[model samples]
Target chain A: MRHTINLFLMLAAFWLLNSGHYSVLMLSLGLGSIVLILFIAHRMDVVDHESQPVHLSTKLPSYFFWLLKELILANISVVKHIWLGNSSISPTLTTVKASQKTDVGKVIYANSITLTPGTIAVDLVGDKIMVHALLEENIQALETGEMNRRVCQVEN
Target chain B: MDVAIEIMSAICLLIGSFLCVSGGVGVLRFPDFYTRMHAVGVTDTLGAGMILIGLMLQSQDILVIAKLVMILLMTLFINPTASHALAKAAIHNGLKPVLDNKERNNTESESSSR
Candidate 1:
């Protein structure tokens, strides 16, 4: 089926990309065997595969650029706080609604927020996540829904 | 031109290796995990990125350049996420930030009196 073909293509593509020294004989034989094995597996109905739901591949770069900007701004804020040497460290926890419908999209969003300084995803409760922010401003940013909207643009 | 490019590449590689070694040393010698992470994170990002850029410059073809860029992208995505996750996990598991001995003593005394 399509799943089998997809898997074979994926593996062969990786192999070809990584092979460095390419030979036509090696390419045909290696890729052929991989496809053959997957074809057999497909006939046996042994592999079940699901595709990713993030369809906006073309928009992914824009999303990434936006995240990078946010990260840089967050870094500046964090550096400023450190320079001030005020360790008030007021940690606040709150739930933020995830705009993405797919599980993968939600995970990516949660992890992206957590990767930025001053924010941590403490827990996921259905469509909302409990996030702990190191400062009040970070939570306010999330509340504004700017990041959520960009992630939704990608997920859609 | 090739010689100049190679020399520049070598210089970059040397600097990158020095940074990586210094970061490793900091990780080993730093007083606490959080401080060590701070040293390691910044140095490693700079070190790996510079090294990759050097290697990319030395590469032969467009395919190699594209592959190197992908590797750089992966590092950019993975490094911050991994460090943040580690820090968050440590905090959630009650890993308190290291305070000076005086502050520690004060905290202990306050807890005991309470």
Candidate 2:
């Protein structure tokens, strides 16, 4: 039920932002389309906790800010390496253990790893994630499990 | 105030462009596929992010700002997903990553011991 409302609100907001039309006809059409889409979604049985993720609303902003900070730092590191040339880069591939219990949590962790500049999550097998890092420092960063712990926090 | 905003936007765009150029260089100069993906990731996350943020600052309309935010969100979500898919597909096709000496030595020792 909450998920349905959340989806409706999200769709409506998206429509309004894109349309920028507030005429009675346009408004009615937007509402009608939102309802139709909601109906289809409900029929498909995809409107659930994972689909909507309204529960994470409160935690997401902080997590995103942290991610942005990490991204900037990562960009600086990568930029430095790029200028220093290939000799400075020592690529490493290793498996990092993820502590997230749910699929969503695991995905968040994996995506977070890939989102960072120097590391990519190649595969997720059970709770272990195969990661490729451009530098040894990135592998060490993952070994610390800070991102994994933050994702677990997001999940709960 | 307008001038200040313009200056800030210019700075952001400059930095963004620099990042994009460096990412391109990294892609061309990097040894292999996975490393190239990392370079691309840097461009997708920080390069595009900074550019969008700069554009967002220049736009005064609330709708434009909202749309910019939406675009940023979409990029943040989709870029990683696409990278993951490509990386997974490459690995599935038996693509091997170029590893540093330390990792290679560790693997070699462990295999020899067994």
| Top of the candidates by lDDT | 2
Clashing pairs in 1: none
CA-based DockQ, model 2: 0.51
TM-score, chain B, each candidate: 0.83, 0.87
Which RMSD does model 2 reach against the true structure? 5.3
lDDT of 1 by residue, B1-114 (tens): 999999989988887786666656655543445545644553545567679989987998977887887787778768767766776788779876554443345545655798
Query: In model 1, where do residues sit more than 4 Å from their true spots?
Result: A1-10, A32-54, A79-90, B1-60, B76-114
Can you tell me which runs of candidate 2 are displaced by over 4 Å? B102-114
Looking at model 2, residue A20 earns an lDDT score of 93
lDDT of 1 by residue, A1-156 (tens): 555556766677667676766878888878778878777876777665324222455787888777767765664454444443324334455789997987767877887776566566656669988776656778899999988887887777
Residue B18 in candidate 2, Cα distance off native in Å: 0.5
Q: After best superposition, candidate 2 residue B34: deviation in angstroms?
A: 0.2
Q: What would the per-residue lDDT of candidate 2 be over residues B1-114, giving only the tens digit for each residue?
A: 999999999999998999999999989877678989988987898899899999998999999999999999999999999999999999999998877765456545655798
Q: What is the Cα-based lDDT of residue B85 in candidate 1?
A: 73
